[model samples]
Target: MHAIRIEEHGGPEVMRWTELPDPVPGPGEALVRLGAAGVNYLDVGARAQGTGGWAAPAVLGAEGMGHVTALGPGVHGLAVGDRVAWFYHPGSYAELLAVPADSLVKVPDGVPDELAGGVLMQGLTANHLGTETYPVGPGDTAVVHAAAGGVGLLLTQLVKARGGNVIGLVSRPEKTDAARAAGADHVLVHSGAGFEEAVRELTGGRGADVVYDGGGADTFTSSQLALRPHGVHAYYGPFMGVPTLRPTDLPNSILLTYPVVHHHVATREALVRRSGEVFDLLLDGRLTLRVTGRYRLAEAARAHADLESRRTTGKLMLLP
Candidate 1:
């Protein structure tokens, strides 16, 4: 089998498509033949800095869907040939992955392989923002930064589905339509800050009920400014840049939260349940998975490059 491997952390150039032995399922593990792997900024962070569990000399991916080719002892409720998807298992960039069966959810009939493969990481994050972080409700307004990006698009659709209005913030003018197409009630073209005033104007001076901020530091203050007093600021876009602030730096009575996807799915039961919620929306057509770029597994470096350039919108997938 072949997988993208990195011996050192640096640029996308560090990722190498190298040949390796095929993986075999161990106890409670399912051998998954990689159908597709979602390329996230998380993977880029891992490749560049060996972030978290992704140390060097490792395969580089976290979320994906695949077919069950084999099952190990004690792996029940799953069988060979079952199509399964996982939200996070690490080492998912390979042609085959031996993932713990409990870590996966069965992909239902209506969801396509590519969509199943790509949606969970970002989908679940969006779910966390809308359902838990702020609990969006009817007539509430939300500010979604990078509204054409993967998480942004999903978050926009979810906020709208939950009866909240979305004011999408996109980096370029070309992305405005994509945000609107995803059900953004209003779309603003922004390069850095300054979208707050428009959000306030749209909300008639009350500001948004919550701001799903993925713009990182450059737009942090503005994200706060866009929110209503006591409104939630869910900052999940640390990859763009991380900003620090004193407690006194907070404006208004706005609540600031860094909602981690893990906290939302901290247990096996929670993982299955939250994943079901996202998948149900996909099946019902309330949520859409847009694959803006698809690359052969070997071309992952180029995919990373495209993602980092911020020119690619929606999802990018790697097929093995």
Candidate 2:
């Protein structure tokens, strides 16, 4: 089998396509012949920083969709030939992956492989963020940073479905249309800062009820300024480096949260329930997955470069 491996921490160029011995499933695992693998910031950042819970010479991917070709001893509830998608699994950038059976989620019949693979991690994160973390609902005004990015796009759609008004924040004008298409009621490009004033102006001085900030330091202060009294700020990612907060930095009665999808869907039951909900929404056409870029598995470096460049919208996947 062949996989994209990171032999040393560096830039996107550090990712190498290499041949490897085929892997066999261990007990309670299944060997899946991958159709597509989701390329995410986590994968790219991990490859660059050497800090994604693995070391050098590691196969670096966290999610994929595929068909089960073999099962190891003690595996149950999933069998050979099952079409499945999983998150938090390593080595998904390969032609075949050995994933724990319990980690697998059945992909619905109509969901394409790329879509399934594309949404597993980001969609699940959006699910918890939209429905559970801050609970965006009727009459609420929500602000999402990086609104045209993978998780942001899904989060925008889900927020709209829940009856919340969405304000999407992006770094460039090219991303605004995609964010609007994803259901953002307002899309703001961060030109010369002071985006908080725009949010206030759009909301008629009321500010947003919730801010889903994935951009970290670059947007944290402005996101803080853009919140209403008692509003919640859910900081989920560090795309611009981590930000710091002080007690005096926020409004009175404000709530600050940082929800990670893995922690939210930590168990089989949680994973199944959340993923099922996302699939239900996707199948019903209430939610959509957009794969703006596709790369051959051998072009993993270019995929990472495109992602880091912030020029691509929605999801990027690798077909093996």
Q: Tens digit of lDDT per residue, candidate 2, span 1-320? A: 99998888889888888999999999999999998999988887688876546678789899989999999999988877889999779778999888989999999899988888889799999998988888887989999988999998999999999999999998899999999999999999983347999999999998899989888677777787899989898988764578767888677578888888888798999999989999999999989998899899999899999998878899999998
TM-score of predicted model 2? 0.97
Tell me how far candidate 2 lies from the true structure as C-alpha RMSD in angstroms. Answer: 1.2
Residue pairs clashing in model 1 are: none
What 10-residue stretch in candidate 2 is worst by lDDT? 237-246
- Candidate 2 residues lying further than 4 Å off, grouped into runs, are 191-193
- Candidate 1 lDDT: 0.93
Best by TM-score: 1
How many residue pairs clash in each candidate at the backbone level? Answer: 0, 0
218-254, model 1: which lDDT tens digit per residue?
A: 9999999888889899999877789989989998988
Computed on alpha carbons, the lDDT of every model, listed in order, comes to 0.93, 0.88
In the predicted model 2, the residue pairs found to clash are: none
